[model samples]
Target chain A: MMIPLADLVTILPELIVVSAACLLLVLDPITPSNKKDLLAWMSVATLGVCFVVTAGSMGDRVFAFSDLVVVDGYASFWKLLLYVVSAMTILLSIGYLKEERIDLAEFYGFVLLSLTGMMIMVSGADLLVIYLGIELMSISLYIMAGFKRFEAKSIESSAKYFILGAFSSGLLLYGISLIFGATGSTRLVEIAAAVDARGLDDSMILIALMLVIVGFGFKVAAVPFHMWTPDVYQGAPTSVTAFMAVASKAASFGAFLRVMLEGFGGMKPNWSGLILGVCILTLILGNLVAIVQTNVKRMLAYSSIAHAGYALIGLVVAGWVGTEAGVSAKGVSSMMLYLAVYSFMTLGAFSIVAILRRGGEEGEDLDDFTGLAKRHKGAAFLMLLFMVSLAGIPPTAGFIGKFYLFMAAVNAGLTWLAVVGLIFAAVSAFYYLRVVMVMYMREPSPDQEGETRLALSPTAFVVLALAAAGVILFGLYPWPLVSLTATAALP
Target chain B: MSVPVEFYMVLSGLVFIIGLVGVLVRKNLIIILLSIELMLNATNINFVAFSSHFGNLSGQVFVFFALTVAAAEVAVGLAIIIALYRHHASINVDDFRLLKW
Candidate 1:
């Protein structure tokens, strides 16, 4: 196939990001250490441009690189979300990296590269493209996980994450090959057609679909494959943890929805049972295990796992949503909206983790929040909003996101699963509410007598404020985004 | 006559299982990474086998991409393991348990 320049035009967002990453990589070593923040700012600028380019492509149905990549509202939605995430990550980390004495210019570059990977993953139409994109995302995340080279736990997280991540990639690749064997093509459209042409009872395709789900299950940190989450989250630098929790996991959902909905929509009944099981298991374990945890980061990690489970409910609904384009209930788009909502909420919660400190140590202990409201009313209020939103309380964006998922599930006649999810949803409030209580109701810890001042960088404050504003603004007024996501349904 | 596709499938499956077992049971992180490589190569075998049986080149092409990515992952993986070794003075996965719940 002859390469055409016009095809690159369709992938303007990816192109802009790639060139910017290359430029940043080249500029990293030559630039002086003090001027490194310039590189960070420049990377943010790059993302800004990429964001505009992606936004420009919104609602256009285009495919690039020989239909290997697809461009649509779905891809546009994720790219835009990830761009905001990357920019927020850079802004939030600048001060923290300096304070911790772990400054690395390449961090920005890796982030952009990973963001580009996410863009590629969302736009991918071929399994090969998706797999490579995933590797790009995972390998970059593994390195970023260990960016604090002097910290033993950081490197340990990287090592453990790499081994297990590679093992999962093997499973994913094996699944891809099995899928190829059954369908004779790695393209999702072709695979879908093959399924329709050949019929659904092909046992090989059923087995392949299950294997593929297992692989994605690991990526999204679902119940049985989520052993690596808490340790890696607790060990990683909090900024990177925030990024991994929000952007990386959300990107995995984008890829998962694409592969499952586009490729295996024909096998809906065969796979919905498996996803339903995973969803219930994730909700039960993620919330239950979180209650016993004291570390703030680990607790949020389990919360994220539960969030993945909640988001998977959207996938299950999408599974039975059928192949018609004009279908009313777009469970996957609601999931995308849920993903965007969840990302900002998680970012806000982890931003607090990224910036807060008690004594000389950075604060991640649950007790670090005691008497927080008495000291810093703004930060405490924001944290309260984030925690409430996380528990799916009303008048927050999480509530809106959850309402959509449950509504879609019911629309698909999965009322039993939706009801079970609702019970677990209520069960989750205990821990999220505990943080609010500690911050607002409890007296300050005596050990840190005079260290009551809550400090935040201007950038972190803006990011946190932006996230909170998004949660409330969208919660009360969700019409614009609801319709946007409704239109962004996967083709 | 040529070998059956089922034969290739079984062989690749066996290799994949072996690699998976090594990864789960091995104490040395290096060996575990190597086992990951083994698992990837087993997938490559499956890809190539299917490509030949189907007389199409896409699967074979996918094998090459997977090989290159596996190399990149291993490179990054080794760098991480080495960094861990520098800090902890042991490559044993058992000793690298500082951040566990």
Candidate 2:
């Protein structure tokens, strides 16, 4: 029953976030209204420390809490990504919070706490731990989505998200229970071993796996389970929407990869076709629907769904090609790399949205950005960078991400899905480019009276710099990231 | 003292179906929330039942976690519903349609 202190050190990043969240909860009442910016800074600092701790653990693998929590290359990669995204989100929130008059200590606290949940989710080795991590993240996000207490849409969005999220959690827990019944364990590795030992192909386990997929599908905003995303993204404050778009999706995919690749590796054949069908549907539906959207935020929401579909291609390929072809780690690494790049590009895109909301107005509609190039040239440039990256144009990270994913798929003999994805990618380019054309070509709306000029906060500037740099740098020199991704083996 | 697994499975299935119907068919926001709670409790019951049937504690522990999560969800869900009610002055899903396809 003795827990090793060394194992505890391995999960220091999660510990840091938990303590920071608790600290913020306690500090909220004592801090005066004029000084609440301190809380935002504290959240940023906490995420920074967590990032350092996660970075320190790179290449070190250890299992803690009796193998219920693992620290490995995959976990470290995701933890670092989560911390970086969380930090950028806090920065983006600073300007949005000030403009919306939503400056509160609890807001930042919830962001950090939710990020803690995401961190735990990607690292959890036990099914129970995964469920707990998911709830922790979900509960915090539900509150943050409704942080604008006076806004009707914000409240509605949060209500819908909470109701649906709870329902999905139930489905996931039930699935885990069924798997536990069949395999006699909730530890993922243990469950895999049980399945192998018994050579069991129980129907109960299949149902369980399907339930889990449905549950996670909701989180990742995949088609048929993505009803809440557009509404929520449109309703929540722009900063929160950005956080939801980037961090939440990355975290869900992180856990999704772990659960499928680690827990249900043996059942790949059963679920691969189901995921493939969903991926195609999501890609087609997400892109085709996005093309008709007038609101930029809503359009991005649909685009996020389509991107999830693309990430699923990497996952399906990982399962089929890695396991079936005995490539062991290449396919999974490719999926992980896609996830990492997707996180950066998506965050950068949202960062531009966050920056453009000036003078107390949350400019989310596509028209709100008419002639933005004249109003704020630097931000317009960044926005253009994000859009091009999102469109998978050359010399941006998004292109490489999609390239590797398609390569992985083709390697797995999923040539047709890859081709179909490319077609959708081209279809998606119209909307992404439409934003660019509006920014550069249109005349500024006289009614679009702002402070006339936009200024970037230090945090937002950093986010923009990192994201823009990442898109371009990774596009130009992808070998380093590709190699790093290749080295991170999945268990 | 062995209870049938079919009984638990059937009960959970019914509860899940009820939730699905509530989400798909109900117009009242509160009813939808209640249905979600019902669905979660159904899962908890299944977890406990499986734990007992298997004579293991993992499912029981998971049930406890699920219950905790359900409680947190209700707290947040209710707060959100209350906020929505304040703004729209209605608890019906049909009333809340600012952004439509």
TM-scores vs. true structure, each candidate: 0.97, 0.96
CAPRI-style class, candidate 1: high
Off by over 4 Å in 2: A1-3, A197-201, A321-328, A445-455
Give a tens-digit lDDT track for model 1, residues A306-417.
9999999888777764534433246787788898899889999998877778765678898888888877888888989999999999999999999998888777778887
Q: Best candidate, lDDT-wise?
A: 1
Off by over 4 Å in 1: A321-328, A452-455
What local distance difference test score does each model get?
A: 0.88, 0.83
**DockQ of each model vs. true complex:** 0.83, 0.70
Deviation from native of the Cα of residue B90 in model 1, angstroms: 1.4
Compared with the real two-chain complex, what DockQ does model 2 have? Answer: 0.70
TM-score of predicted chain B, candidate 1? 0.96
Query: What interface RMSD, in Å and to 1 decimal, does model 2 have?
Result: 1.4
* Model 2 whole-model lDDT (C-alpha atoms): 0.83
